[model samples]
Target: MVVRTEWRLRQQSPRFKPQRRQAVSLTSRWIIGLLTAVYLLWLLVRTVGQPDWLTQLPALVSELLRLVEIGWLATLLVLWGLVWWHERQEAGQRLPPLKLEELYNLHPADFERYVARLFRQKGYKAAVRGRSGDLGVDLVLTRQGGKRAIVQCKRYRNTIGPDIVRELYGTLIHEGVSHAFLVTTADISESARAWAQGKPMTLIDGPTLVAIARSLQLSPPSSPKAS
Candidate 1:
């Protein structure tokens, strides 16, 4: 009886929200294409075989106008199809952003993957340097029109201080790169924050990182409960 009651309640519950509008089915599209082809063939036969059809206008002018209209319609349809395909390919390539809960659970290696994905979305070539002998750098990002940038991801639970920031500032020299970024899940000390001002490197704390993630159209991080 309890199981039966639960089943009844579940049946009354709302369905899962669909993420995207359903695409037209292959069969439906094929049917439409077939009908359009048949219609075009019929029009061609009528225009070619019928001598009195263009009585109001020269047959050449009527045929040319019909051809022009068909060309315009075909061009529009091709453009529309290309746009749809590009958008679908782009949507598939994007990496979903991390939630706060997920961030808190991520290992350092996974954090590097997350940051690398963000750079990828922005059209930068970014590679994780790995945990061993990374020389304090997690990601090395580069693009043709941009500077070669080094990223250090610190997924610490506690506050990261100035020492790490200074270390990353020094890391650029060792890596032979001009730009460096210190990305962390934890907040920074005021002294560290102040020290970063006017420096060559940038420090991104948790809140700022979340803002960046949102701006990139990645999944926005969920707010964590007050500690």
Candidate 2:
């Protein structure tokens, strides 16, 4: 199954990587704009109050205008640089599907991302929902024929138990998905494997995950550039 999407891969800049905060950038811009306006107003009022107001108005206004231009230009440049830095950092951190040992080293959120990418590479439309309050579903996978499956990723050394498998089954029913996938970095207990048998569920352990990663001919999904 070769799942297809509109994303294309781009080379990442290796210089720097930073976490992005869109709100902070927007707030900074607003602050600069407000300060610029107040400064210009103050300059105008000070010029008007001078004894030879008319004589000095031209020079004062010209200087004020130039100052505003320079301030705005510098602010814009700094904002652009911040945006570029964050984007580059994100791009640089996109790792290819590698060894299971390497997968074990990833943050839990990053592990979810890795699993989503893995499924996408295997021809499934996968979306990551590994956030707080996301229910038990981590990644939702849709097949070409419109069949849907929900995935739960566990990236830890703890053995997967029947309870977890059973919980995913309940989630599968609730979500109305056709199947459930429980991917874990550790081994699945015998009871857990037995519980999943004859059910619409698949358990992927560390070895199996590593095997899949090794077999893949990766064409990673594109990360949209910040506007």
Candidate 3:
């Protein structure tokens, strides 16, 4: 049974928060285009009816041609410049695919984010906790049907011991979640694995983490929804 407390409720984070998108109305665009066309048609009619229209036609056409040339040249230059700048930005933002070897080089906070993202991709609603005084909890995951789980990430090269697993178990009790996850970049000690048996906790090591990553890459992920 899970214990419910005010503090535990406050500690719980949301999965994916839904955001409303702002839309532009097609009707408004159509109305504006129609108005512009009508105004241009009216001006053309008024210009053609003038008494001096025939006498001034040559000079008027020459001036209009010059303006159109200048306007088209400036517009083309601006569009070309914008395309070049956008291409440069896209080039700068492109990232290489994640490799298993690179996980060892990531910062602790980044490691936590990576774990959270992996869980999210696997169809869980996951949130990374704040860095300061999180009480050993790195991430909180809420699966379908409102089952909550806490995650702790360890980017260690050395094997994890039972002490750490015991501490996370205590945190799980405090958080009152259905389960807990401990993700590490190294193997769990034999004692640690034994200590976690029959508990509402799962341990994930380096190779397992890579396997999960590869599996997700091969299979399309289901969209994550808030529980």
lDDT values for all models:
0.66, 0.69, 0.69
Worst 10 residues of 3 by lDDT: 16-25
lDDT of 2 by residue, 1-227 (tens): 12222111111212111212433544565775676676666667756764565455788786886787678667766866775575445334444445665666555665776776667556566666666887889888877567888999998798899999999999999999888999988999999999999998999998888777656645444432221
lDDT of 1 by residue, 156-224 (tens): 779988888788878888877767888888888998988878876888888777677667774432222
> What lDDT does model 1 reach?
0.66
RMSD of 3: 17.8
- Residue 191, candidate 1: how far off, in angstroms? 1.1
C-alpha lDDT of residue 76 in model 1: 53
Model 2 spans with C-alpha error above 4 angstroms:
1-95, 218-227
TM-score of 3: 0.55
- For 144-170, candidate 3 gives per-residue lDDT tens digits of 888888999998899999999999999
Ranking by lDDT: 2, 3, 1
The TM-score measured for candidate 1 stands at 0.54
